[model samples]
Target: MDQLPTVQPHSPIMAVLTEIEYESGMEPSFGSIHDFCLELQELFTSSGWFFYVFSLKGVTKDGITGLYRDGSRWTKSKMPFPDIVYNRIHSRRSESSQIFIDFVEKMNEASIPVFNRRFLNKWEVHQWLNSRKNLQRFLPESCVYSRNSLQRMAASHEVLFLKPVNGSRGRDIMRIQSQDSTCDVSLSSRNGIESLNTCQKEDLPAILKRYLKKQLYLLQQGLPLLKMDNRSVDFRILCNRSSKYDWRVTSTVARLSAQGHFAANLAAGGDTIHPLRVLRHFFGEAQSTSKLDMIRELALEAANCTADSSEELFGELGIDVGVDDNGHPWIIEVNSKPSKNDHIGKSSCRPSAKAILEYAQILLSETNPPEKGGSR
Candidate 1:
């Protein structure tokens, strides 16, 4: 496996932002996540504290020295040690899986605050975030799968979206619709749309079989979201918990999908607009502003609700909010690390990165207080 180059050790103040290096065995490149870590590092550095990023992958000085290896023994490095280990490892399989897990365990044992705390597992987080009672106002009818449940969902709704339970970036998403006794299916992709029409009663069994062979997925009733210029639109609400444990809205933007596309994801070629403008156009001057206010309230409520339920020390969240024809807001999804695409400091918005860094400082203060001679 290839390795990441390392930076030279600076003073202790500069070393406060070390990262827990993830081995290259992980599937997705850590570029985006790494950028986030760097953002946090910069934020901490400006706050009079040092930040250092440490990865288990051997630490190399400008791609020369390899301090660690796959089968080699671990050793203390000359680099400044970390006061906290942010567990961003996403590896599902590895030869050193046990070793990495142990490292995280040691960090926890040492009282270094971990972002997720490992208490709220992924499934638990999803269930809590998507619960009907908790987020009913902002969610569509969604149920974890079984063949019978999917068939029932198909029978009731004209169209439904089937998604992977652990999916992201709109991958492996399919739309199913009923047409008399026949059912139509469309697979979503960046390349183009591929679809098939089949009998609902007779074809469901085979379709379910094919879907089950892949992985676990969820069946969701399709929401009738308002559209702009024949394209569906959704809002990305960025929320973060300050050091004071108060949830604050960092930013919100309207993502409008291109014509003929169902997803409004940026990766899917969607364009972004101001939410205030989109809502005003969709609802008209008199009623649109009121609706926007309501959407903001609901977004903040959902963020607080999720933060209250989870035990993790999360400082930020990216929530996808959809507005129905009734001018009501519904949550589409909650992202742990919301992208900085339309971040504040950009065009008309506040810098979300700055807010996130400030929040992290607060969290760190709460978790790791300064010594008697030091400042928090």
Candidate 2:
């Protein structure tokens, strides 16, 4: 395998793309997001940065490539170190993994700006969001779980989603809904409902046991989402912070979940539509117009809140916002590494991806004080 170019501590700005490999049994097959990652690499490359991607499976031409495997001897080229690193490590793979963690720590101590800084753990992000007042308006009730907390949350919400605390792109999510004395559990997927049935209240013990065996998950109250043709629809609001620290909305689109599915994730056979049209369909013309404006403002505010409170230097966020029947907007999830799906060919939203790339370039060029050092 070809070796990665060695980077100096004070080298010119370059973007490092690295992947965190999953455990042998626990990786999602590559999908649209993988393509988006490539587009980001191209964008970074075009902006005069040496863009490189490292994965456990060895390098490929798809992105500036590097690879790592256990017990494999390797060497890095003598070149200037990357100025910025895009940490795209998968979460399940990261748990109890030393190699990638060590690499990230070394980069941090060297003052290389990581897009989603390694120190900014997922729980910290959630905690930051929970503490903010402006963000509270958009967020659903969310809590990190202990066995007692999870049980209480389940009993209180009657309908909750159990999500891997660090998971992304809609994988390993289980929705638990209560119908009178029975509870229904369903796993999220791209094809269709993976499982659906009624479980007696007494089944909670076993279900919780199975869920807790994983050792990490978050319980969130399910948002009452507006539906299209009997399927839930939610909005993905893309926002990016400019080098100047101003937060801007890059794109907002509605994702209608596949029929019979509860999630509105695009990866799961969900189709995209203009948010305005969906707003109109759910709310009449007069109300829809006003609601769109409201949603846009809320999204920008949510993004800013996350950016300001968190220690990470986030250039972008993919915030999942759901609209209820009454046209109220609620933040369902906040994604630090928002997918660049808007860049897919010949789409009206493609420009958003270009804009994000440009913003990333600006961020790479400018220097901001580290969050711990001082105020921005």
Candidate 3:
């Protein structure tokens, strides 16, 4: 007999949709999905936005058939057109489908705004940022990985990274080091980090051919990243659009790689330390402030650059930046469909989540402004 809480001052309804394969109660809902919806609902309701969670399958042309709080339990209910949609379609396979594309297009035609539009391709983002002269210094030399490109980069930089153009969570990344007679290759796999050593540099093409036969890869010069406890570390800057549509750095977290691993992605057995903690640990308290400011500025620039390039509206980005031993910052990667994990920020506020709803409200107000009575 536990009643579902109701939203307050619910004038504008917001829908959060994700891919759900089966009906609820037929099977257990994904815990993460449920938690995400629950958390978002609480935040949205507190801010006077009516929020509900629905699956893609539940949407229709007339309106959306979604689950809403009905006394003690969630029950099927129909909702009018939503003012905005917060997409949480987590499956790559689902997003790739023609059906999903058509659905989004249809929603667009119906005038519903979707935030954090889609996943960004690494190469496309790099190419966009690389063309800007101001951003060029922060970008490492990167090009489509080909037999010749790999060899050329190997001849230039002592170490290079081969990354999938569409990869996430540091999956399938490889670290390649060109030695006098051999190329040292280390791959990040689900099982663990694996390395291929003592392979003649001349035979790299043949050896890599099988692995990259149909995959797209980017070869980037490896920066001498700052290390923590002898493990390579990088920063993940969570940026979100303000109510005014300006990009703001919500928070920055430092990810330290597992020993012997090059990737600092959380999925790759890495650990996260707050950037302030990292700064204090590396540079004394007296010097951490300036360095922190430098990182914030760099991250803001990257976020704005990405926003300028993307034609679709994106409200959030996770930008990975690395600081070399010399203290120069480099843009490593930019993720549009960023995972919202551990977003606790200054003053105990979940900045990323709060920013999302605030921006969504701004968008909705612009799109569907309330009528002013007895006004000029």
Candidate 4:
């Protein structure tokens, strides 16, 4: 076998595309960004990699107006665009702006690889993955929300989820359960589940029509997830793109919702813990291992399919999966801009930060390959 190409220790500067927000006295700060950004800086300190955060309007003909590291302090200044950009702009609305769109077009014109350029539309993603035969098994039955679609989906599944195509952090999702003649609708948000009161089955059309308005929604089949402590349990698998059609599972952890809660996302007050702790509770040691292995395999395959289905590039993803009581795995969702878990205890930099740094290096090496048999 041939040896791998060597990249220089002085890696190219990387830019994280984000939304700029100001704090007290106009001190710019993005909530919870420091956890991941600082980790990026600290991880490859000796390896000569520089990372900076900027927003949609920061790009220009000369350079970017972004926050930079000046020793231990962050200072706002003009800096040159880096070799690669990773999108972290939280809002899909901001990402849809003309400024962001133009930047991506220009980057493509320059042959710059900007992975995760836009957030995935849940309906579009479901169609992409569902259209593929091999991937369909892992996907729950879903359809673009409509009076007809919702009614159709409701007819099959006793419980259904009404998810906004652009929803995030487990916010603005509607859980509707059939109750003989009435529909019990509840909404899921970061705080917890809020009752929306029961409504007549026929009235759901008008109710959802006014509430959802023009925004797109996906009505999906709800899963019968494994529950522990009266709360539903699911797994989050962080995967990073290693090569074309190649993805590596970076971290796997189980998220358990509090009692009476429907969402298992950390943003929704869910708790993150080792997958084994919960898996072992349901199955024997060997069976638990098998279950986890199956989940990871499904996650990687889902990542590959999702990436392959997209026209743009993707360097990382957070694939959420939930296993049923029968030990079957189902794809919950795929997130391009996955949230970082600051609650996981700052014992050390989670491999997630390192995985991102390594993927950035891979991008650097690919776009600007090093000279053979030499070091910089």
Query: Relative to the true structure, how large is the alpha-carbon lDDT of every model?
Result: 0.62, 0.64, 0.76, 0.79
Candidate with top lDDT is 4
Off by over 4 Å in 3: 1-10, 20-36, 60-63, 69-76, 345-349, 369-376
Off by over 4 Å in 2: 1-13, 19-80, 90-96, 118-123, 154-156, 189-191, 342-376
How well does each candidate superpose onto the true structure, as a TM-score? Answer: 0.77, 0.75, 0.88, 0.89
In model 4, where do residues sit more than 4 Å from their true spots? 1-11, 24-28, 342-347, 369-376
Q: After superposition, how far is residue 122 of candidate 4 from its true place, in Å?
A: 0.8
Model 4: per-residue Cα lDDT over 287-332, one tens digit each = 9998999999989988888888888788888899998988889999
At residue 177, candidate 2 shows an lDDT of: 83
> On TM-score, who's better, 1 or 2?
1
Q: Any residue pairs clashing in model 3, and if so which? A: none
Across 1-376, the per-residue lDDT of candidate 2 in tens digits comes to 3454533223334444545333455532234455554455456545544444455343222323342111222223222345566555545465236755665566577566667543234566667776877667667777776667766877788788877776666777788888788888888766676775567876765765664436577778887779989989888888777555787776788888889777787667778888888988878888887887787787777777778886667777777889987777987777865655543236533555466566655654565433322111
Write the number of the candidate with greater TM-score, choosing between 1 and 4: 4
Tens digits of lDDT, candidate 3, 1-376:
2333343333677777775445645732533456556666678767766767777676666556676544444555665556788777776777777767877887787667887767888899998898789889999999999988987899999889889898888888888888787887878786566885548989888877756637789899988989988888898888988855588888888888877677787766778888878777777798787888888888888888888888878888889989887778899999876665645444433667778788887887777543321010
Q: Write the per-residue lDDT of candidate 1 for residues 83-186, one digit (tens) a residue.
A: 44444444334213665566556546655555633322234545776663756656777787777887788778988887776666666678887778877787
